[model samples]
Target chain A: MLFLRDFGPTEVGGFGISSANDLLLVEDIELVHQACSAVHVTFHDESVADYFDRQVDAGHTPAQCGRIWLHTHPGNCPLPSSTDEDTFARVFGKTDWALMFILARDGATYARIRANTGPGVQQELSVVVDYRAPFAASSESDWEKEYLANVHDAALNTKDTTVKDRDKSRSDRFDEWDESDFCDPLLQTQLRGY
Target chain B: MKVLVINNDGGGFADYMDVEPNTTVATLFGQVTKSSRAEDYLIRVNRQPCAADQILQDGDRISFTPTKIEGAAS
Candidate 1:
């Protein structure tokens, strides 16, 4: 009964998550740990990076596509930090139709589910209601398909402008870094998509 | 259901065995902290945020985490 919303990073990776039908979706423990391991250090495998890219590309239409990003705190802190906020602001500033999820080692997770409305001036992130509730079952309903189509088209239409602008800025920032410093090797591969 | 309580601060740990369903989150906190305050720790159910008054169900995964960490946003 896990329904996942998919989104792409145009230049980065794809992200999304399972939604609760009546409560919160408890992610598979092993999957959380795996995601944590992938993001813990600097670089991730190129294949993983490509997987995300393909998701984003596929979600180019605008029906009701969802994007999910996964990360973990080394210890047990689950609250987002200044850096996390900054990154989210930069990455989601343009599209503003994505969601974010954070998993902590101590089994604490947080979700920011975006609300689509208005001229995209305001965004709302809701905390999961019940962590133990089963996720909503996926449906191939016409409404669902139509919603997905809208999101896909919206993504494609703004592909050049929004995503390109963000990626360019991200690359500029990357160029300022010192390659020799102790960088997380995983990050190198993850950044390849961007 | 048995729920494991792990507090990240100073390695504080506790366990609630055979907890009944329909237990309020606030009541669970009271059970976890017998004497001190429960307001200090940030409680999460299976990783998502929840209010103290929210009800707990079967097979719930709960953890008590701290407010701060080194090299993390405070």
Candidate 2:
């Protein structure tokens, strides 16, 4: 589970790791560091291409590298609109494998995976939780406690506390902690008609 | 004078080439790629985008970044 420092809009690029045992670990998030307007996130393909180069330089094979991409949504909608699919297909369709993760404002998560083929295969995945052991207090945030408390039938009426409180707490967080890794797992509990 | 050329397309490599003085970026692009294909790329001089007609400066880091990035807002 990740939390944003400020609820300000951003488009981050990252990848996920998955195994045959239904285990997923989303890692290596790269935020767009370029300057752009608030409504748009401008990035060059070379940046991602450079990322792949550096990953290989670090001895990670291409297969071990993440091909999936992640970004955030201003709304709590967990469904992928046609634009998302189209973009995914256009950019990552020919790749060996890829996935897209959308983190919503209310913290809901929507994930889809594509297989390695000529055009690729598309499938929606259910974000699930089977309960892991208690994490260290330093490793997790108090937000999880608040999230679990309001997990049932969570609703938003234009005044969301999750993102607001996060912005307030950003200064208190460790400087090294990435504020963009903002998906709380409890968000799945809020999924409607998954 | 020498200029750095980094092509974003396949077979791209960061290489330097000798050129005559006052050579414009457009002329250099034509000399290196042998085509006007720079039109498909977003050309930048020293990390700042420049017009093709802008004169090149010695030791400037020019990069040709492909414009075909695919993504969408949710």
TM-score, cand. 2: 0.46
Would you estimate the TM-scores of all the predictions? 0.31, 0.46
Q: What is the lDDT of residue A73 in candidate 1?
A: 50
Binned by DockQ into CAPRI classes (incorrect, acceptable, medium, high), candidate 2 is incorrect
Listed models, DockQ each? 0.03, 0.16
Q: What is the Å distance of residue A105 in model 1 from its true position?
A: 1.8
DockQ of 2: 0.16
lDDT of 2 by residue, A1-194 (tens): 34531224433334443332332554334442222222223344445445444544564443444455666555667566666677566555544566778776677888888775565567888765435633234423454443322211112222233333444555566333334333544443343324
Q: List the residue pairs that clash in candidate 2.
A: A2-A181, A2-A182, A3-A182
> Which regions of candidate 1 fall more than 4 Å away from where they truly are?
A1-14, A17-49, A56-66, A114-194, B1-74
In Å, candidate 1's interface RMSD is 17.8
- Candidate 2, residues B1-74, lDDT tens digits: the string is 88866653333345677778899988877765544656555577766668989998888766654444433454
- Prediction RMSDs, each to the true structure: 20.5, 13.0
Candidate 2, residue B13: lDDT: 47
